[model samples]
Each structure stands twice: as C-alpha cells, then as structure tokens.
Target: MAEPSKSSSPAEQPRWQSGTGLAVGMSLGTALGLTVLDNLAVGLSLGVAVGLGLDALQARGSSTAPPQAAPTTPGAV
Candidate 1:
C-alpha cells in the first residue's frame, strides 16, 4: 500500500491570497448600492469599504493561529 502525499496543494492557498470574502463583499455591496441607491460613486466606495473590512477581519483571524512546522522528508536529517 502507498502512503498519501503530505505536500501542500494550490487549493490550500492562504486566505489573503484567495480574497474570496473581499470579492464577494465588494460585488454584493456594489450591486445592492447601485441598484437601490442609483449612485455609482457611493456604490463603489461602499463596495471597497466592505471588501477592506473583510480583508482586515481575515488578517486578524489568521494572525492568532499557531505557526506551522516546516515539512521534512522521510529520510532527510
């Protein structure tokens, strides 16, 4: 039987790199503000603010996590 690989994959990218929350927040804020308020400037500003807020939150959450140990090969000293 073969052992499963322990290497990190692309899907394991850090939250900051992915920007998933920021993108969603910006899109939703802009869409709602524009359609309801009919103001592009206000809408975009709100969107950017929301995205930044989400990014900040993610950063804060990640900062408190314990550091990860470096990976080692099976036979390496």
Candidate 2:
C-alpha cells in the first residue's frame, strides 16, 4: 500500500496567526468599549484579559500532537 501523505492540510495555519487575530480583536473591542464608555483602565484590562483567554484556548486546542521528526534518507550517515 502507498504511504499516507505527510504534508499538513491547507486549512491548518500557524499558531501565531490565531494569536495575532485575537490580539487585533481585543484591541478593536477595547477601543470600542472605551469610546462608548469613557473608561481607559476598564477597557484595557478587559481587552487584555479576553485576549489572553483566547490565546490560551487556542494553544490548548492546537497542542494535541507532538512535534514531527525529520524525515531520514536510506543511506545518509
């Protein structure tokens, strides 16, 4: 039987992209909240908290598999 493909699927993106997305979301949320509520400390704190939580969740979800080993050649020392 043919060996299965080792390539990662196109749908899977690097973990940093997800964290950056969460950071952007939090920044926007905080800006909106501050503009609407006139509170800097509350907005910043809430944004940081939400961003950290989302990053943690993303890390948890993506860590199921261990790192892959490098492929070896048949005759290389």
Candidate 3:
C-alpha cells in the first residue's frame, strides 16, 4: 500500500505567500528609492520632459478660437 502525501493547508499557503510578497515589495521599494537618490538630476530632467510632452499633446487643438454665439433677439429679455 502507498502512503498518502502530506498537503499544506490553504491558510498556510496564503501566509507564506504574504510573507514573500512583503519581502519582494520592500526590496523593490528600497531599490527605487536608492535609484531616485542616486540620480536626482536625471530623474528631474526626465520628469520635466515628460510633463512638457504631455502638456504639448494636451494643447495641440486649443489654440484655435471657439465659434461665436448667435445673435439674440431683443424680445428674449
């Protein structure tokens, strides 16, 4: 006869996953923070470039004047 395999509980799996997730999140956060600190000038320049590019795209069709309102009759007061 074969013996039954040991299976982990569902709750235990989630707890292990949660611990791994926290470690990964902390590592990523630390790397990103160190990157920003190490290259503040480049980051600022890139941010400004992106901001200006977005602004330009947003302003593409705004320079044209809007249509004028139609003339109203005097009796409409």
Considering every candidate listed, which one attains the maximal lDDT? 1
Please give the ranking of all candidate structures by lDDT, highest first, separated by commas: 1, 2, 3
Worst 10 residues of 2 by lDDT: 1-10
Per-residue lDDT of model 3, residues 1-77, tens digit only: 33453334334344444344344444444555458656555555555555555544434423333644556666777
Q: Which wins on TM-score, candidate 1 or candidate 2?
A: 1
Q: Residue-wise lDDT of candidate 2 within 1-77, one digit each (tens)?
A: 33553544324656556666468657966896789768877777777777877766666655644656666777769
lDDT tens digits, residues 1-77, model 1? Answer: 34554433435556457676679777977897779979877877888788888867766666556656666778878
- What TM-score would candidate 2 get against the native? 0.51
User: Model 1 segments beyond 4 Å from truth?
Assistant: 1-17, 66-77
The local distance difference test score of each candidate is 0.71, 0.66, 0.47
How does model 1 fare in lDDT? Answer: 0.71
Model 3 residue 76 lDDT? 75
TM-score of each: 0.56, 0.51, 0.33
List candidate 3 segments past 4 Å from native: 1-37, 61-77
Which candidate, 1 or 3, would have the higher TM-score against the true structure? Answer: 1
